[model samples]
Target: MVPILDYLLQRQISPQWRGLLTALAEEFETQIGQGELRQLMYRVGCRFAAAAPLPPCSSTADLADALNACWQETEWGYVELSDEPEYLRIAHSCAPLLGFGAAALSWTPAFLEGVYQTWLSALGAEGLSVVQASEFDEHATIEFRLGRHPV
Candidate 1:
């Protein structure tokens, strides 16, 4: 496990803050709807990617290293990228989205989708799209696929 993540996992969140976050998540969903909230979060993620741009990577390994470094710094999860016949498969794990409460989990993964999409686009994958392909699993991992959108 990453040292920062290990420390974070060891720390406990206060119940008051947890309840507040839960209420805020429920309010956001109630006011904006899940889809719109996801879009908003996606934009927020785009901004994050822009703020902490990755250096140019000449290969997939380099890209992975760069991404891991960024994730380590941000304490966001780590990712595993695999080349597939049709698309690039991204398995991201250990994200702290659960800190926002269960309600937020339904939409917060879109933020990661946006972050990856923007980062890959900046890396010259102009026509590829990054989309969440699975929900958070037991390990707080989510799957994303990067490929051209179907017609």
Candidate 2:
């Protein structure tokens, strides 16, 4: 059962969208720069979160479940949330952003940052911020941290 589920989760993005995202990444990077492209993608993510707000959740597990439902519905991948003394650690795996091509990687994770920031803020995590903590690992997973706003 776990193997089958892993297979499903590892499904690749469709070639059509992959090509389009790759091209768009190139164009955006060439025209507006990677920083600007990241900001744009972040806004796109914020809009996505706005369109699909999660249900009220009282516990970390419940919140993870709600977030997983959203990810599964969109085939965007799933996240594991861990409670830490200082912040929430978010490990997101199998995101379709990889399909945007290697060049897109430098900025695409910002999209997830934006998505999580909005969602967490909506959950009453005011005064906190979500930021990428690490780059994509070999398994295409990325790490994010949600904590008090940086000085």
Candidate 3:
């Protein structure tokens, strides 16, 4: 079986994101007794970045590096995640370099929009509607709804 580390090392996550990945690995290891959790991981790539718009890394280390680069190597320090510093700190520390942040680097508004769409897909939002309203200086609201009745 491809161990979690095997997958991360394949991805090219940045040093910071690498640490976060290590943390997650430890967390999973601790929860190892719960086979379901491990199974969940097996189902979803250890990095949860299968949705990334990049090439398939040839090696695990490369995958981690690519993922890390995709996360931390954004347009300067401009990202469009939760504005809350506390939350942003947690997310920013490991969040993928996308949305406004990626746009910052590529200067392509769609890059930012792409990130937003990716976020929606990651959250399993099928048939969902997101209304975005920009707040001064990269702040925006994403109003959404579920496709079917809430479970």
Candidate 4:
């Protein structure tokens, strides 16, 4: 997700990328579904960011400019934010740069030993920061810090 969106931003900047994206997407949809497509997309995206998972930029302007060309290309097209799916919430929440970057639902303690560990591990490896808070007396609000970021 975060990785894929990052890739999408990067891809959008290039001239020949739309066709490349179309080809990649069609291949995925034909060979996979949303789940698998997401996994594959993230895998491909991580490669591009491998050189520097995080870079020290002097100001927000630098980051904005750095992202503008790419963002305008991929995200320049209209997006229907009002219509979103379940996974949309998860992707948006856990992705690196979104405003709401994480939400943890309360489950049996056993669940944490499984899903949480795996997810947190991957997120940490990717340099996302985590924040947690108890939710609705049952669930918890666990998220990654998206704005100020983490070193």
Candidate 5:
């Protein structure tokens, strides 16, 4: 996945183009609302996962560890995981979204939420939800609520 993302980044397809695509999606999402967009993306991501498949991750902790490894391998960014009693707090640095500029950054949270939600579901993680809990310059924090089912 990292390699594919790298190829996209290197090709003329460029972050700007990707950002534009995301912007279009975001614009369309406005009418549907962010939550609806997130749910839609999550379902789409699940279908994508069905086709591509993720490596086995038995537990939510293991899933987080695997994701951290996957993110590091991709060269798109680094993710540091800190397990809390209630949830997993992930500090993300240099994710590809940074290349998308300020306006497009908003698109990432819901998209990543979808992707992560799909990944967790694929791993058979019941009662789990993922969200882009917060953000700062060049950094984002993803919160994974384990053992609590999505409502």
Candidate 6:
């Protein structure tokens, strides 16, 4: 998704066309209920993990390093992780979600949350849960807490 959007941006595509595409995507997603969308995202995440299981992250530092490496590989965003005693905090500069209209912005977070939830599940981090608390412009802030699983 980010790759395609970035490609369009790199080619200097018209903003109107981008907006139109974004709008259409948002509309399409709306037709799918939250439960179904999340199920699909979970499956996608599982598939991603099955494709290539990277080195296991056994500690917060390792998790941070792994996430940053994944972000670099994907070019989806810049990710920063803080391993606090109470929670794992993540701040992301999601480049693809930038410059789009507000309507398009709403769905990306939920999709991302689903992805994170499933990815973590696939990684066998059953005790950790992803909570998307805030989004401002292109930046998104999420928190992960131990012992609280996402249902």
- RMSD each, Å: 3.7, 3.4, 18.2, 13.8, 6.0, 5.6
Tens digit of lDDT per residue, candidate 2, span 1-114?
255444553366776686787887888888998788889889988998999998999999999999999999988889999999999999998887767777788999999999
The whole-model C-alpha lDDT of candidate 1 against the native structure comes to: 0.84
Ranking under TM-score, best-scoring first? Answer: 2, 1, 6, 5, 4, 3
Best by TM-score: 2
- For model 5, the local distance difference test gives 0.58
Write candidate 5's Cα lDDT for 17-50 as tens digits: 7667766765755577656655665676566545
**TM-score of candidate 2 relative to the true fold:** 0.91
Residue 25 accuracy (lDDT) in model 4: 47
Residue 95 error, candidate 4, Å: 17
Model 3 misplaced regions, further than 4 Å:
1-69, 76-108, 135-151
Cα lDDT tens digits, model 3, 1-151, are 1355334333434555645645654565466544454345334532344455544555435434543566565422223333232211111221232222222222222233344344444545455423223311222212212223333
Positional deviation of residue 52's Cα in model 2 after best superposition, in angstroms: 0.3
Query: Which has the better lDDT: candidate 2, or candidate 6?
Result: 2
- Which consecutive 10 residues in model 5 have the weakest lDDT in total? 138-147
TM-score of each: 0.87, 0.91, 0.26, 0.32, 0.61, 0.63
What lDDT does the true structure give each of the candidates?
Answer: 0.84, 0.86, 0.36, 0.32, 0.58, 0.57
For residues 8-115, what per-residue lDDT tens digits would candidate 4 score against the true structure? 544534555545545554554566665554344444444433432333434434434433433344353221111123211111121111111112122211121222
Which is the winner by TM-score between candidate 2 and candidate 4? 2
Q: Give lDDT tens digits, candidate 1, residues 1-151.
A: 4556545643544455667777888889778988898999899889989998999999888888999999988777699988899899999988877767766888989889989998999999998899899998766679999998785
Which pairs clash (backbone N, Cα, C closer than 3 Å) in model 1? none
Q: In terms of lDDT, which candidate is strongest?
A: 2
